[model samples]
Target: MKIIAKNKVAYYDYEILETFEAGISLMGWEVKSIRANKVNLKNSFAYFKDLELYWSNAHISLYMAVKGDEQRTRKLLMHKSELKKIHFKKTTNRLTLIPLSLYWKQGKIKLELALAKGKTKYDKRQSEKAKEEKRKIEKMLKNYS
Candidate 1:
């Protein structure tokens, strides 16, 4: 898959439990802008509205001569069963849905979304420390070989 945009902050701030693929409804201009790599997934998330899913805070830079909101809410296409499943988790498990990445698959734009739980400040610090230790270990192993 060719990735157009990624939300790295989502990974750092949440503990992912499950992931799923989703299709996005987009305008022609928005598609063109995305092809040019003028998309941002930062702070973007998916929410439910009357049993349907909508994407918010994602930005697609306007194509020249196209006037519209760059961060307008967009609809996400998914199966009813999957939607119901996600909603169940959301309501009972208190998990949130977050966009992990935007990419192209089979010539169509696809969204990789994760069901996650928010991490505490301590969790963030522990992850950072673990990463640093892993990096140091990898470096030492490389030098030893």
Candidate 2:
């Protein structure tokens, strides 16, 4: 799969519990924009409305040759069973659904959705410390080699 865009901050701010692949409903212009890598997954989230899933805040810039809304809420297409499962987990665990990445699959655009819990400040700090330690270890090994 060729990944087009990702929400880099999502991993830093949330602990992912589960992941799901979803089909995004996009207009022709929006799809073109995505092919040009004019998409941003930041601040984008999925929500359930009337038992259906919709993504909000994901920005797909208008194509240079086409005119359309850049911030429209897009519907996510998934099986009914999957939707119910996500809803159950979300309500019971108080988790959130975040858009992790957008990618191409079988010539169609698909979204990677993650069920996650927000991290606390201490958790963030610990993650940062662990990352720094890993970097130091890699650097030490490089020098030894």
Clashing pairs counted in every model:
0, 0
Q: What local lDDT does model 1 show for residue 17? A: 96
lDDT of each: 0.95, 0.96
**How do the residues 57-95 of candidate 1 rate in per-residue lDDT, one tens digit apiece?**
998999999999999999999999999999998989988
Q: Judged by lDDT against the true structure, how good is candidate 1?
A: 0.95
Clashing pairs in 2: none
Per-residue lDDT tens digits of candidate 2, residues 1-145?
9999999999999999999999998898998889999999999999999989999999999887677778999999999999999999999999999999999999999999999999999999999999999999999999999
TM for every model, in the order presented, reads: 0.97, 0.95
Give the number of colliding residue pairs in candidate 2.
Answer: 0
Tally clashing residue pairs in candidate 1.
Answer: 0
Find the candidate with the highest TM-score and give its number. Answer: 1
Find the 10 residues in a row with the least total lDDT in model 1. Answer: 3-12
In model 2, where is the ten-residue run with the lowest total lDDT? 61-70
